[model samples]
Target chain A: MKLNERSVAHYALSNSPADHMGFLRTWGGPGTPPTPSGTGRRCWFVLKGNLLFSFESREGRAPLGLVVLEGCTVELAEAPVPEEFAFAICFDAPGVRPHLLAADGPAAQEAWVKALSRASFGYMRLVVRELESQLHDARQSLALHRHSSWKAIPSRCKPQAPDHLSRGLENGYALSRDCSSIGLAEEGGSRPAGSGLAECELQGPTNLLLGRGQSPVSPETSCFSTLHDWYGQEILKLRQGWLQRARGSQPECEEQDRP
Target chain B: MRYNEKELQALSRQPAELAAELGMRGPKKGSVVKRRLVKLVVNFLFYFRTDEAEPVGALLLEHCRITQEEPSGFSISFIEDPERKYHFECCSEEQCQEWMGALRRASYEFMRRSLIFYRNEIQKMTGKVGMGHGSGRGWLVAWLTLCCPPHRTPWSSSAYRKRPGSS
Candidate 1:
């Protein structure tokens, strides 16, 4: 009969009497955790499905109790392998070591393997939990970005400098308006200076409100040649108005006022 | 030829080995492969470079089929060299296209969720949380480049389909 490829070893406590009892004494020992000696190795058997085992030995030591399981096929390789046994020593209470020092024989070794296999499942669960938590946090951050308000966008544009005005022109914002201030620039530098005018130019009257800057061409104007020039003049007019208002309000500004 | 329903089911059950066979490896040896399986529904294209300063590798799927289409196709491709070219084509016979579409959608959703998780992990690691520079944006960009085409082709009304000239 051909060996089934998918068939896996299912471990049971009753199958191996000596191994089961040895595990209880070694791993289930009272008041202390199991620890391997410097000369010994540690082995774990996955009991739920396949008896997949993982073994690690300390430095300068040989591997012991190494076994393979695949669907009722159990084989143990010859020991005294060139690998050392090392285990992290954890103390539970005052002077209480969690090392299994008593499980030295083959039966005890088998039990230890089974116990380690069970513990591995727990470890996998913990790792999965951590991954889930990480995923949850990421979703929250994405939500925040998606729902952020337009006012929250980094304006990069400030009223303080001409460099920002140039950058704003490149980014497609030709005009920006606030309650007391207005800004205007040419979308493309190629357009002639007097051909186009923006609505902000007519702040007092005859205002042509360009549709929200959705497209490359200004919605109110069909002549692309005159677009920039017209818009630039309107901007100059708004600046002149602000300058005139400033002069009128200043107490010491009368000497320099235009005749 | 394309995989059928039964074949896809079998493949899903063996993703770990399949992923390894396809050159995907975990960060550590003997570690369990944790990536979600993503199937390519429609023919997909991906371009990436091993490093930002390197040239790009172009991968094309001529007639790719996936298991689903809801989550989109979530996949990772590693390129050793920028100029290397790879192709994976599948037939659109029978239910192959249908399955591929479904797989593609499912993968997109999975990737969307995974990216969110990845971003959060990056923020936590950097200790400068939020959606700014410290927010795994770089990692996300890298991940997207590995998973999909880096740049979108501008719509052109050319007579023939053109492949970008090799650098």
Candidate 2:
């Protein structure tokens, strides 16, 4: 197949952050098979995303060998040489020999194995998607809290929350636009009916509250339990505000509301 | 750079993320659009003859731009040479948008950026919440620093230095 070798090489030489980098004794490259004697050339290996590039040395600009870490499994293996920390990146492809590599110590060996194993495009996507959903949940809950509080006091200092929240959403929209613009909207639309109650509660006043920071898009984590606890604290504050208001004393609600 | 083509060929044989017989055109001079089975697998976009099991070519989606062309088409061009583009024509505008979105997200760099962005936002939210409550941020930060120290390559004061540009 006609591979984009030039661009791949450029990416290897680029200054993008290397996921893992260390010296490794490599046995197989291209037509070479793993030698039974375990003797191999030690090269500086840099793992960039899913591509693993081996240089002639640490300062070598050009890579001698490139291994795309897809459709492969990393396993601990016995090195041909005794006392050497070794691992093998094995691929199930026919005629493709396993790349036997040895690290300096046990820690390095374990680290390499872990890094290589997780260095697939699919793994990264799964994590991103998880975080995306988590961020969505966070926003939904925050909107719900704001709605309840706004209803309690109809004419107070309008907390600058919808603006801030929409700023974050704007950033998110921009970031998602590069990949899939419709993805965020689709996610928002497909949310369960329970959150739709929150949506219904948020619409009236928040719809009129113009977001100031609606600049072009950007990008969150999965902290559901912690978020729930945080929102629980918010509920407490809301209850306190209601109690104070019932006593004919309007406390500075905005101070407690600022996030 | 020497890499095993057989390995990539094996990868192309794996189940695809999206596969369709689309009209493809190379960046070569006077290249005309032709029907090809384009399959996206991991970060590689492999194009093959409809009848062939093996791919005719593969494009690594890293450091590349997927720009939507007018009238149900899109083009992919690498950072190295933006002018040279591999164009694909979809059946409809919706199909073209779908292909463009898939191609844009098919890069490892995109996934990496998304990861970093999510991590940052998560940290901000967690820190805000953990102001009164203690957090595991220390461990997370330590782990992140160990795994992904920004701008720092592996070697530092090692006694090994090679001439640059040597292969």
Candidate 3:
């Protein structure tokens, strides 16, 4: 069929609400419309709630598929026969002429079918490839989160410690100061000469800090306090590291020349 | 698949009865379903950006059946692009009703993120452009209005239907 010589026919049918079984029962059936019979022409019946038919030359087939559902308007060159099935929209029309199949022969028809099938297949393959790329990107993002070093800190740090330890580190420089103080306190004191006890006020009898401390005011008392502080600082550093790594991993945009 | 008006209406009605139908009835279930729907909608917007350079904020209704352990769920996956194919799925009747509500929330967040990111980029670009006082503001405002609807004060929701007879 020549592109301009071909025409489209549209019919809007309404099915009884009482007869409605389901979408499949109403719209899905075999007797809807026959596929096109000749060369250089194509017929597409899009079974949206209403059937829309485009009888165009082969060139217009693509634009039909690309049509947006909203602001959806169809122009029919002729009226179509109403069918007995459920409510439907029918379009029988000629689309854009198939330029690729300009030479008319049995061999051309066969080649056209083959080409159409190959083109459809290629389109589907492109879709699948794009989806695979997306899935790959999602997997890579999840993997980056999984293999990160910050994942270790929570496990290495005492579980009994407050969650605030991690939060404090991210917000301020106080955590680093606390770590330095603890290191200083631990180095300043030694065990007593005769009692085999730590001579420093901050050091407990067992030489362990935090829960074991005897006096709240002792310099040794600051041991647990210092460790708590340092622990928070370490967590902050790890979080910052993750943030930096994430930022660095992002793809760099090409620089445009300034006018 | 193309859905009819009745089917669309049925889908819209589902979320309200979702908790009741699942025997998971509770007041909070409505909100939970709504929140999930919103998340799905936001995800759809991101998918939309994959193909088109200009943002065309339009909704689509394409239905698909999703099987779960307890019962088979019906969902309509909205598509913005068939190529580069970004879409949001509103699975289950409850989701259909809640999806648009969720989309609004998602759009707000997306706009916020875009504003923050663009603001930073503008600052960087300005530094490279020799740091004139007003050099970056024009571009920043232009980008912000395009990406973030909330920044466009006159065109905001409060002003949306204020024209005569709009209501």
Model number with the top DockQ: 2
Kindly list the per-residue Cα lDDT of model 2 for residues B54-121, writing each as its tens digit: 88999999899999887889999989899999999999987886677667667777666655555566
Which regions in candidate 1 have their CA more than 4 angstroms from the true location?
A: A1-6, A9-119, A149-259, B1-167
lDDT tens digits by residue: candidate 3, A122-230: 1211222222222222333334345564243322222211122112211111111111111122221231111111011212211121223232112232233353353
Clashes of each: 46, 2, 18
lDDT of 1 by residue, B1-167 (tens): 01112212222222121111111222233544222222321111212222232112211221122222122222322222222222222233323333333333222222233334544554564343253442222332233234333232111112112222312
Which of the two, 1 or 2, has more lDDT? 2
lDDT of each: 0.26, 0.60, 0.24
- Global Cα lDDT for candidate 3: 0.24
Q: How much DockQ does model 2 earn?
A: 0.28
> A65-100, model 1: which lDDT tens digit per residue?
212111011112222222211112122123333333
Angstrom error of the Cα, residue A89, model 1: value is: 11
**Most TM-score-accurate candidate:** 2
Rank all candidate structures by their TM-score, best first, as comma-separated numbers: 2, 1, 3
Candidate 2: the clashing residue pairs are: A171-A218, A174-A217
- Deviation of model 3 at A80, angstroms: 21
Q: What level of docking quality does candidate 3 show?
A: incorrect
